[model samples]
Structures are given as structure tokens and as C-alpha cells.
Target: GAGLGDHIDRKEGQEHTFQNADPARRQLNQSFAVTDHCSKPLHTAISDRIAEGYTGTTAIRKDAVRALSLVFTGTHEDMKAIEADPEKLQGWLKANYQFVTQEFGKENVVRLALHLDEKTPHLHAVVVPLVEGKLTAKKLLGNRKDMSERQDRYAKAMEPFGLSRGVRGSKAVHNSEGWYLGQQQQAQKAVLSDLPKLTALDRINPARYEEKVQERFKFVSREKTDTAIELKRRTDQVRHAQASQHKAEQEAARHREATQSIAAQLLQAGKAGITLDSSYALLKAPAAIREAANTLFQEEVRKLADTHLKQGAEAYYRGIYQLEDSSKATREDYERHQKHDSEETRNHIAGEITRIFNQEIQQRWGVELSPEASLYKELRKKAADLVRELAKTILQELRKALGLEEPRQQRKSRGLGR
Candidate 1:
């Protein structure tokens, strides 16, 4: 996409002096006259205009006329398809030109110039936004209605060409949504309402209260440990599946090697003039026994070749069977692993709830004397410890499942306890 100012140097009677404006902001103007008589020569006219310096104009003007040149760049994939048949591409452009003109405005839109001299083929569409004395950027952008409505219309317009709406970034959508102040107010209110309630006695007898809190903390830790264990189990199942597939592939390769070895042995025996036993030989063999034996030997050689050919087909079928079996086994193992992991995770989560109850609820109430408070605090601590241990175990299992090398253990001291 390119844009620049046009008519930088005003004609003798014009009021505006476009050349006096900043050169950085101006568009240099040039025009070309073409005859409609020859359809085949349209490309030649466009090439001449590009060479004469109309597309990349840089002249500045104080009150310059607004102009834009749009060039559709075909990707490598599109170029490949178009190169297969150039006429198909030409027809496509001719059909889509009307839509282009409608978007830029019928009067504002100029003739398209096709340039075929460059390494990449592209169409140059020159547009002058100003029709009469008025110029509209919104009109040129095809923003005739509200943005949402325009998007819907654009989707409909491009549907026939197998083109869908372009994807806008997630940030753009977020910014658009955040424009409304009411959403901000609702978000603030929701956050405040979710905060936990505090107790009055939390300020007094804090030491006694802390004892009960610690006990509950242990219980919550234990539950999280269980969850980590479950995740590890799932990872192990995936590894098992992969191992099974590898074994099947190895077996297949061995079978192929065995088949080829047998064929080679048979071919060697045939060349050595080895005779088959009488039971194996056909009748009318003794009269031309030497020639008949040779023919029989050649038939055996052909049989060996056929067996070698069958090995390839057999390997393919075996591979396919292994793939299907491995896929099914892997899926089953994963499902089982997930089930165990979820159970462990649930236990860990339960432990967390106990910790939260002790720390945030029971401890605040200063209920250390109560048997329930002490039990809860102990449970929370246990749960937290268990969760930490399970996490380490899960990490080890994940490495093993992913075929990563296990870490070496450090040597322990041989001395007895002091």
C-alpha cells in the first residue's frame, strides 16, 4: 500500500502552490494516455507509465490532492498457482476490479496498470480520493457504516472469492471492549466482593491460635502431594506406549532380515547345481534330465525372488498393525494415568482447603483449645509436606516418561549414626 500527494506544482491559474509545501509530504504527479483499441497492449502501456515515474512520486505540496496506489502482492503459493495458467489470473482480476472501484469510489478509481517486467507480477491501481472539491478518507477505506456493520458487509462481499474476514489481533479486541467505562466498574466491584472475611479474636491470643493453624496446614500439604503423584503416573503410561511401539518396529526389521537371508541361501544353492530329491522332481525329467534340472533350478531361483518381494509387502502390513496397536495402547494408558493423577490432585486440593480453613478461618477465631481446630491444623501441615514430596516424584516420573536420563544419586556416608 502506498500514498502520496499529487499536483505538487500548481498550473499557472491555480490558487494552491503544492511545490512550496514540505517535500516529505508531497506527491509528484504524472499522467498517461492509453488507447482502448488494443486489449493485448494494455500491459505495455502500464510498463511505460511505471518507467516514467508515476508510482513512486515524492514531490511536496501545501494543498496537495490526495492520491493512493494499491498493489496486491501475491504470496509464493498464489504465484505458483497463477503461473500454471495466466489467463485464469487475468479473469480473476477483471472480475474483482468492480469491487475495488466500489471501495475506492467509482469516480476516484483510475485504470489498472499491469507490470510484467519484474521478478514478481503485480497490478498497480491508481486512485484519486478527491472527486469534484471534496475528499473522504472514510469512503476510500470502505467505512460507509459502523465498523461492526462494515465488517459484516465486507465478509459478505468477499465470500464469493473464497476469502474470509481478516483476523484482528487479540489486543485490538481487548482495547475495543475496554472503551466502555461500565465494564471497568463491574470488574472492580467483583474483585472486592471475593475477599475473605476476618475474625475479631485474631488480634488476641495469636500464639495459641497459630498452634491450631500449623496442624491444619500439614493436612492440606498431604493432598497436594497426591496430585503430583498422579501426574507422574500419566507420564509413565505414555512412555510405556512408546516403548511398545519401538519393540514392534524392531521385530519387523528382524523378520525382514531373516526373509532376505533365506532367499540368498536358496539362490546360492540353485547356482551350485544342487538337485532336488525325486519326490520334488516332475515326471519326464530323466530324458532331458540335465536341461530339465536346469529349468527346475531356475524356477526355484524365481521363487526365491518372489519371496524377497513379499517381504516388503509383509513389512508394510506389520508396520501398519503396530501403529494401530500402539495408538490404542497409548490412549488407554494415558486415560488410566489421567484418572490416577486427578485423584491425587483432588486429595491435594482437599488438603489445601483444610490449610485455608485453619489459617484464614479457625486461627482467626482463636479456637486453639478446640479439638477440631488442632486436628485441622495438623492435617493442613501434613498435606502441604506431602504435596511438596509428590511434586518432586512427579518431576522424576515426567523425565523418565519423556525418555530423559535420570539423575545419579549421591554416595551416602558408610559410618554408623553417632
Candidate 2:
């Protein structure tokens, strides 16, 4: 029996942290307990381990939790498998212990106890926050983000044991086994709170109340159907929008290719004029011919640069629209499957795409542009590089056609434009 001042809800025959507490429970013989700090009972060992670490901090936080006690169990059906096979139960217990030991370093895991006496097998573990030889509960398990990650990691670790993590951000709240049972009883009572009066007139006139309830139910069903239809209609609209967006993107790409072709033609003309001038200079032609050739070459180079910039800007905008469509498609696919993508996954993919896009833009234009850039600058530097390469090839072919000795000065300034 519980003594004075003890919790009234503390039911009898409940298992405690102490070993060999239940005499009638035959499965207690199979129960196992372990601790790294001491051979003492589970509760005492956990307390001592935390107290020892507390010496490192001069000012202890009042709201801090020195140790975290976690209970690991499975659904009733999963438990049934363990009940049918003792080996299966032991395997589960070992997996839980291993997870605790690995997560919080083996030295920081104070105690692990498997309770076989309970109807459902569960392992209770006490982990002290002792990272870098200091007591820091906040560093261990203080925030919701860390807690969510812990759940994910635990679920992955328990995957081989056939356990799953609960839905993230669910409405269901955690409570002790006793508290759950009490809540269940309270809910059963609450279900009848709106019962009609049991008068003789009411008993004979229950049809009126039944009709009202039926009408309310019919209204709810109609609303549900309307909402579902609206959702389907919206889905179709998005698909149509995506198709139109893709078509627009293809047309924009063709326009950009045409613009780039114009730029290439201008670059080729400039290279040809420069090659002709160099040949004339080697053949000792008049200064008038060389000067005219230089002017034409400069004009062609300027025109080529302008066209290239226009082409790159157009291409950048095209990429932006295509990327937007891709993102919409990703979101629509998730909606179609009715599977919610975690914000973390979505953000990670978005970040990766943004990084790759920025790198491509920087390489193509020699300048990093913002994601929402309305105007892209001229890629004169890249255009010049392309023109220089083509000029080298043209220069080599012209030198072969003229059969003239290459001038020493020309050879010295051979790769100057590049």
C-alpha cells in the first residue's frame, strides 16, 4: 500500500525502479538491468551519476532536467509478436538499450532496465547530460527541433526491429499509462453529456431530436463532397497552368537560340576581317587598308558583344521560368499523392537548386545575379573569350593560306587578344 502523502493514482502492484520488486511475477527472472557508474539499484545509480556531473557547473539551472527517462514500447500488435516469442522480446530490449547507449555516449547512459512483469514489455532508460565533461541539459534535448530529429533518428535505429515513429506534429499528446486510462473513462462519460431528458413526453417524442441530428449529419456530408470536388477542380487548373508554362518555356528557348546564332555570325565576321588585316599587314599593304579593316573589326566586335549579352539575359529568364515550373510540379506531385513533405526536405532541395543555378549564372555571365533579377547585365567578358578562341583558329588557317613568314611582333602578340 502507498504511504501517506503518496499519489492516490499510484496503483498497486506497479513496477518500481528497484530490482526484484514483484514477487508474484515469474517473468521478473528474465528481466535485466545495467549501469556503467555503479552496481547499485537503477534509481540510485542514475541519481548519483547526475549529481557527480553537477559539480562542474557553479550555478545550477533551476528549470534544468538533469536526466531524461525515456520509455520504449511498441503497439499492441507488435507486442503480441514479442509475447509469442521470448527471443523476439529480448531482441527488442537489446535494440532499445543499444540506441540509448549510442545516442548519449555509453558513459553518459546511467541506467537501462527491461520490465518483463508488465503486460507490455518496455525498456526505461536514464540518460545524463554529460557532454565534453560538463552537465548541460539544454545542449542535449532542449528544443523541439532537436526532439523531432531525435524521434527520426530513433525510428531509423528501430527500423530493423519493426518499430515506427509517431506522426510528427500530431494532435495526440503524451501521458502516463494511468493518466491514459483515466482520460478514456472520462471520454466515455462525456459522450452522453448531451442526452435528452428522459420525461415521458420526450420518450414518445424522440423522433424530433433524431431528425435534427440526421439533418446535421447530412449537411456535413454535403460540405465534404463539395470540398473534395473543389480540390479536384483546383488540381486540374494547376495541371493546365503547368502545361502552358512548359510551352512558353520552349518557345522562349527557341528565341534565345536564334539570338545566339546572330551573335555567332557577328563574331565570325569580326574574326574574318581581323585575319584579312593581319595578312595585309604581313604583305606590306597600304596603311589605309589595315585601318579600314581595324574599324570594321571593332564595329563587328561591338555588335557581337551586344547580341551575346541579349542572348544570355534571355536564356537566364528562360531558366527562371523553367525552374519555377519544376518547383510547382514538385509541390503538385506531393499534393496528388496526399503525402506531406517535411519543410526540411523542401528547403534542402530548394537550397541545392538555388546553389546550382547561381553557379551556372556566375560561370556564364561572370556575375552573380539575384533569383528575382528583372534584368541581366551584358556577359561581355564571356563573349570576348569565345571570340578570342575563334580568332585563333581563323588566324592559323589564314597563315596557312597566305604562305607568308609570320612577323616576330605578330608572334609576340600571338595570344594577346585572348
Candidate 1 C-alpha error for residue 205, in Å: 98
lDDT of 1 by residue, 311-354 (tens): 43323322422422322344444334445555456465545444
How close is every model to the real structure, measured as TM-score?
A: 0.25, 0.40
Can you give the lDDT of residue 198 in candidate 2?
58
lDDT of 1: 0.43
Report lDDT (CA) for all predictions: 0.43, 0.53
User: Which candidate tops lDDT?
Assistant: 2
Q: Considering every candidate listed, which one attains the maximal TM-score?
A: 2
- Local accuracy of candidate 2 as per-residue lDDT tens digits, 258-359: 557545645776765534334343233344444554466445434644565435433442253332232234433323322422444334434444444446
**Deviation in Å, model 1, residue 245 alpha carbon:** 28
Q: Give the TM-score of candidate 1.
A: 0.25
